[model samples]
Target chain A: MSTRTPGTDDGSAPLLTLLPSTPGGAAAPAPERADAARNRRRILDAAARIVAEKGPDAVTMNQVAHASGIGVGTVYRRFGDVSQLLWALLDDRERQFQEAYMSGPPPLGPGAPADERLDAFLDALVDRVAEQRALLLAAHSAAPRARYHSGAYQVMHTHVAMLVSRLRPDADPALLAHLLLAPFSPDLMHHLSVEQALPAERVKAGVRELLALRDRPRPA
Target chain B: MSTRTPGTDDGSAPLLTLLPSTPGGAAAPAPERADAARNRRRILDAAARIVAEKGPDAVTMNQVAHASGIGVGTVYRRFGDVSQLLWALLDDRERQFQEAYMSGPPPLGPGAPADERLDAFLDALVDRVAEQRALLLAAHSAAPRARYHSGAYQVMHTHVAMLVSRLRPDADPALLAHLLLAPFSPDLMHHLSVEQALPAERVKAGVRELLALRDRPRPA
Candidate 1:
């Protein structure tokens, strides 16, 4: 947990911050905390490396500790379980994405046309999936609960639903929400990317075509 | 297995009934023929009774045997396995439906506008799912191999893909096939019907609205 400082939009707080920890040196920990912060960063960075290299399922607390050059007890102290560690990794990624889309200019955020925003959102989503391709696959194949009810999934549904509502006010917003997220679904993405060996660009193209076809008018 | 008389449909051989042998039939052995047939009839009747009373999961082989005053091995010999038994029961129901939809009348089968066929197919599908509601639920909760690769699913997809192609020659027929079937997926249906407690008619109406929305022209 990161600590919170007032008027800071840097997206971090100190240890025990509600969201993510602020990385600045302004509110440096007054307690025996500088070492802990360093340890936490080391653990997270090591976890990410292990996840990227060996996939999420292959990552164990002992492995993270070994990779981070810390005692196994420290890894357990940082993240209580493998599930929590995996979740934290995904949450951090999703939070960064949401901040980008919400505050960044044009297409993904609020400065561009709804149509383009929809397209850009789809592209960003597919790219994110591609980047975390290995971890996402491992998590899902492990259990339905691991995949379905994660905070990342909830955030995605909520974010996509908001965008769909903004973009297509006349549509069945909830169903549209489902449709928008459908392409990024685990099963569909895995089928396209890994199984079909399709390039990410192709999936993005299909998304464009789906949007066009879905929005097309009926024959007279 | 029921034996089909060769070329009966082509008028080269006389039609012969192919259902499981009943009592006083020529296929029966002389000793204990009447008793065996009677027990078989009793067992099937009890199986149906148990399913109707307590749903598909409750119609276990042991239960069926006990209900019919027979041994468990008798149940096993008759059905081979629970999956086979379940498939047999559902196949009996599905044959009636396939016959009706393939050759019966307008709207559902042929002789109607292509759009009407699409609409009627959805209505019939929802109705069938609702009619066999318990069995459908049981099947989904069962093993994946038993649930997903059933011949029924293949037949439905093929039937739907064929019809949608005819209806929308300019459309991406395969994608439309998925879109059309979206409203009837077991997960979707269960989510709408059970979790949401939505009226089946209202769900059907919503589906109709969705199709209309899909068919509407895009904003230029």
Candidate 2:
């Protein structure tokens, strides 16, 4: 993990900062020392692992502290509570995802063709949502429409719209991108992956097929 | 409006029946008399108008009764309460929509080619969701994931999947249909139509553009 400042690392800084806003309207804290950043990373990783194994509802501060081998007081001090901690985890994952698709590497990041990058980004999105399904679902349930309003969704929409504009200059990339990303909503993902018991690979392939739908000629 | 039996009017019987299940498991009521059916229609029509003019939150039994020009007792007797009444309105509209798409005409119905039918169906779906945006959003908020499990969604999904299968025999039509339908989710529709204030026609066009995405040649 790069130990850079949380929201300022990339062009997505504005939206990323909206993810884990400080409670009580406190002024932004001073920059984290290297050790504090490392601790934050460890706490978050441990929390994510717990969420992966148990589910978001099962995450308690005590369990997170125990799992991270950090003091519970420090965990509480850093995160304030489980809800805030979970948001932080979500923000953390989203930042990493933003970094990957924004500038980290080719295909998902910068160098690949627009179509290839679009495919890569969507495929990676499927994995990202699946990896954090429970947490995402929990957050989604709290406010369903808020998903579209969130900074994360805006960033994803922006990225997808950029690629879509390149692929189909004649099309409305902004609206098309929203429609394209609609399938990856956490509730739908849960229904497909958990309720219908579909494999993630199958979901990714279906998304690709939807993308490649125009590749086939319309019947006469 | 056809005064046909609520769930038995078409092949969507099973799913349609799931919509307006009685609050208490008091065995299914007997078929309505002609006058009773007419009154039910009036009540539902009145409620739908209120929902359209104001919003679902503004619907009240007394208001519906007054709008339908029927006694409040009759409205209560037929529809039970505001919640059940809203659902019946949804069911009533869905039945009409289902009838239109299933066997009513050429394009959204059966006579047109599968691709045209697919386009027509999605276009109609945009209208359908927009018309019932408030009620559908409330239903979705009540249980976000229950959408996939709902009879209405299932029927729509089945229809879309069939069209997709006819359009692309090699594709996984079921999965594609689900993904294709995702953009029409009530929350997203609410965001687009209400929040973003994009006209329904624009949304419909964007949907069509998404459908036509494959028409363009891929960049070399």
DockQ of each: 0.10, 0.47
For residues A128-203, write the lDDT of model 2, one tens digit per residue.
Answer: 9998888788778767878887778888999999998998887889899999999999999999998889999999
Please, what is the TM-score per model?
Answer: 0.65, 0.86
lDDT of 1 by residue, A3-106 (tens): 23222222122212222222221333356578997887788789889777756646666667778999987777777766666656765566778777777878
Angstrom error of the Cα, residue B47, model 1: value is 4.9
Best by DockQ: 2
What TM value does the first chain of each candidate achieve? Answer: 0.73, 0.84
Any runs in candidate 1 off by more than 4 Å, and if so which?
A1-42, A69-71, A101-104, A137-150, A166-171, A179-184, A207-220, B1-53, B62-74, B81-84, B90-106, B111-114, B128-150, B164-172, B175-184, B205-220
